[model samples]
Target: MRALLRHALTEQGFAVEQADDGVSALEWLEGNDVDVVITDINMPRLDGFGLIERLRAGGRHRDRPILVLTTESSDEKKARARSAGATGWIVKPFDAEKLSAAVRRVAH
Candidate 1:
């Protein structure tokens, strides 16, 4: 899924970086300047909710848009994500077009 999203982003003329888990994502943020973040809820080593919390607490990405891409579609989960500071949500099984659109919406 990550590879596919990376490819799509690159194809659209955006430079892309890959992180396998939330831990590495946070670590990467320490040394990188990212325009936006798109994460899944069920990731290993921290999960998307925890990542959002950490990012918000760090103060660097507090106002940066975060787009949550996950299979969890319950309203409760969506509310929780929004409370955790997610700017948008895209359910899984999405196509390349949808991915690009979501990225453009949040990253811009």
Candidate 2:
């Protein structure tokens, strides 16, 4: 999923940076300014929900677009993500085109 998202974003002219876990993601965000962030729900160190909460608490990334991509398809999970300030949600096994479209819509 990460590879697909990276490929899709790169193909659309985005220079992508990757992190294996939420801790690294937050660390990267400290020094970098990203147009958008796409993350999975379940990850080590800190989960996607925690990442969003932290981002929202921060200054620069609070209002930045955040898209949650995960295999979790439950309505409850989606609602939770929305409440956490996620811009959008994409279920796993997603089509690259669809994911790109969602990213473009939210990033703008």
Candidate 3:
């Protein structure tokens, strides 16, 4: 999944950084600043929802756009992610063009 996402974004000229899970993502974020964030709902250690919450709670990335990409498409989950500060959602297997477009839109 990660490799696929990397290909999709990179093909469109976007540089991407990946993390195994939310914990690693957060750790990477502590020292790096990105235009946007792409995350999955389900992962080991802190989940996407928790990651979004933590980012929202912080001063540095409070306004950062976060896009959720996962297989889950339930409205309940969408609402939960929205409430947690997700900027948008995309269900996998995602279309490369749309994913890139979404990233472009949110990144600015």
lDDT agreement with native, every candidate: 0.87, 0.90, 0.93
Worst 10 residues of 2 by lDDT: 1-10
lDDT of 3 by residue, 1-108 (tens): 789889878989998999999999999998999999999999999999999999999868889999999999999999999999999989888999999988889887
lDDT-wise, the better of 1 and 3 is 3
Which runs of model 3 end up more than 4 angstroms from their true locations? none
Report lDDT (Cα) of residue 39, candidate 1: 89
TM-score, candidate number 2: 0.94
For every candidate in turn, the CA RMSD to the true structure comes to 1.1, 1.1, 0.7
Give the clash count for each candidate. 0, 0, 0
Query: For this target, which candidate reaches the highest lDDT against the unseen true structure?
Result: 3
Model 2 segments more than 4 A misplaced:
none
Error of 3 at 84 (Å): 0.4
Q: Per-residue lDDT of 76-97 in model 2, one digit per residue for the tens? A: 9999999999989888887878
Sort by TM-score, best first: what order? 3, 2, 1
Best-to-worst order by lDDT is: 3, 2, 1
